[model samples]
Target chain A: MSIPRWAWVPFGVALALLAVPILGLLVRAPWTRLPELLTSERALDALGLSLASCVVSTLLVLIIGTPTALVLARSTGRWTGWVRTLVTVPMVLPPVVAGLALLTTLGRRGLLGQHLSVVGIEIGFTTAAVVVAQTFVALPFLVVSLEGAIRTAGGDYERAAAHLGASPTRTFLTVTMPVLAPAVASGTALAFARALGEFGATLTFAGSLQGVTRTLPLEIYLLRETDTDLALALAVVLLAVAAVIVGLSQRLRGAHG
Target chain B: MTQRLALLVAGAALILPLAACSPAPDGPTVFAASSLSGVLPGIEPEASYSFDGSSGLVDQIAGGAPADVFASADQRTMERAVSEGLIDGEPRMFATNHLVLIVAKDNPAGVTGFDASLDGVKLVVCATEVPCGAATQRLAEANGLTLMPVSEETKVADVLGKVVSGEADAGLVYATDAAGSDAVEAIDVPGAEDDPNTYWVAVVKGAAHAEAARAYVDSLVGEWGDDLQHFGFGPPL
Candidate 1:
């Protein structure tokens, strides 16, 4: 495809806008102290928590969100638009507001939480709350991406499989899922990345306790107050992890195709 | 399609510069500590405000935020600002506050006070990085008390919030903060009176609204002293 000359100007500006801040970070990052910073107990704890919680949240999102996307993609109901809008609210909401919403719904004194606590079930300020907060914000990305893919893939193959005497579940597992594998992989990657970077909601809902609730981003925020050098080093580590996730996902998509 | 693309490009061209070049606001932008969130607006409603942990505000000012005035919750933070040459002159002590133990209304946790009974309770406090947190440590040490908090929040407001929201049994926060919120009941911390946190205010070094900024600081320590008191702040030390 031949590129328009005028379009190049805006494209270059967009590239610079993204690249410059990263360059600033790289330039300011304490390269000499990175290894020491990364290996510190606090850094290791935050990194471990970020990875563990993101993995759990991504799995939870897949289990819950896949059905949601499928239902939205296949539904012909009048309320489908509204349902999808509600599902996507977290994506557009300021993460802080999303945290507040979670608190109001599930905190100890929250509407649902009040009832749950009566049975000795508590979610607030726990590791479980961190997972919940992460899953809440990450679910929309998977649902939105997979829904579009399901719509684009259509139901022709699934119908043929059903006509051939394949059960609905079997058709879904074989015909429907195989065709949507690329979308699922990309969506999972996006959800995982979003979970990894989640901060405000997690802090607001789960609270920041080292090794229990504070993820890498929250650690970076706290460290920035007391230790800027360590904070910058941890940010560079997070940037690298995000880049690797993206690169590996792109490769996985190409391989599937 | 071409017309739409042209319109988009023109729109970007028009808005980009305006976004990049933020003109000075009508009034001074007072960067204040989060402990003053409730009272600063009432004290000088004419000026704009940005409230956060004093350390965070200092970082922002150092990183080139266009703050006209800086109000800190403790002497140490204001000293750091002055030491970094972020201030125009000596910061004035405007108000003083001490630590207090706050609990959910009616003392749901049945915490008697800042004593041994607080053990095993869900206590929250400010992190040692911020002003309120530093005062919390000092007060605890002076009283020879050891506290094991469930969470160490970045802002005094967050500490107060955890108590207000019923997520925590107790939180250590400023007297002014506990006094301002009707959702919680305040209990005095022993030795808090001996180590009160002093609030300081000063104009920023290179503020765009330098004159307005100075006037605002002057009024806060002068005529607005009583207003601070009305909002639960103690008189300047």
Candidate 2:
């Protein structure tokens, strides 16, 4: 099929806009110093912390978000619209605002936090806070993607299974889940990527502390202030990791399709 | 043809408003450190100001940002800018600041002094890259104390925010910042007086509004002394 001339204008514009920055990163990256910079204790620490927290948050998103997505998919009411809107609010809200919202509700002096503090338990500035910030921001990605998948898959198969003496739970577990596996895998990857890049919310809510809350983005921001070259190297690392995950997920989807 | 024209008109409608909202090219764009945020507003309310960490400002200036004046919270950053040929001339010292430990108004942690022995108290401080962070390091080294901060924030305002929100028990911030906010109380560090963090102001090369930038810098260096003093900043030495 021949592409229209006008379409190429916008397509080329979008391609150049996206590709130029990545090209710039490749051209300006301190290739010689990258080995030393990536191996530095601070860089490694941030990488380890980011991977661990993002993995935990992705699992949390899958567990909690799957049910929320399923509910939104099955329901058809005014309340469902409001519920879906509420679930996607964090995805649209500024990350810093999300952090402040979390802080006000979970900080030591926060409304719910004050009660928790009374029990001699603190959540702020802990590894748990990092997971909370990540999950809060990433849950929407999983839920939105899975809800779309569930809606597209429809309920015909599940209904047919139910009429044939299959229980609702069994039909969901055996039939609905397998059909949504590719969507789940893709959504998990996107959520994990989003969580890994989380900065403002993590910094504001969990605080930037090494081995606890200082993730890769926070480390890159700090390094940008002190060492630009090292910051570039770390950014390249993040770019590589995100690209690999996205690429793998696309391949998985293709295979499943 | 009509559809393409409509699309073109819609695009122009979007771009025109954004272009109008941008800072006027004729106005003096001042890139000042976040620590000077309080005083700069009082000094030159008309000039467009970009307030952030000095290093970030330096990076922006180096990247050819159209800034007229650069006010840094520390000499080291200004010196770096000069060495990089980002600024036009020598930077002049405009003001000085001392580090102080700040706590929430309620004093939830009961932080009395700047010593390291306050066990179990969660403290926050500026990251070492910024001026306030460097001053914090100097203060710690001089007093032979090891600070156990829960967070090393990018800027002084962030440290103040954490303290004001009671997320942190205490934070080491500029005397001006501590005095500027009623939500937090400042505790004077003993040796902080000896190592004052000086503010430096310089004009950027190829500034569009050079005269206006110079006047703004002069106001901060001369006429704004009383206002700076009121805001708890030390007189330029």
Q: For every model shown, what is its TM-score relative to the native structure?
A: 0.92, 0.93
Docking class of 2: acceptable
Per-model DockQ: 0.36, 0.39
Note the residue pairs that clash in candidate 1: none
- What's the lDDT for all of these models? 0.88, 0.87
Clashes of each: 0, 0
| Model 2 lDDT tens row, A94-161 | 99999999999999989999999999889888999999999999999999988998998878889999
Superposition error at A135 for model 1 (Å): 0.7
Q: List residue ranges in candidate 2 displaced over 4 A.
A: A255-257, B1-27
Q: What would you estimate as the lDDT of candidate 1?
A: 0.88
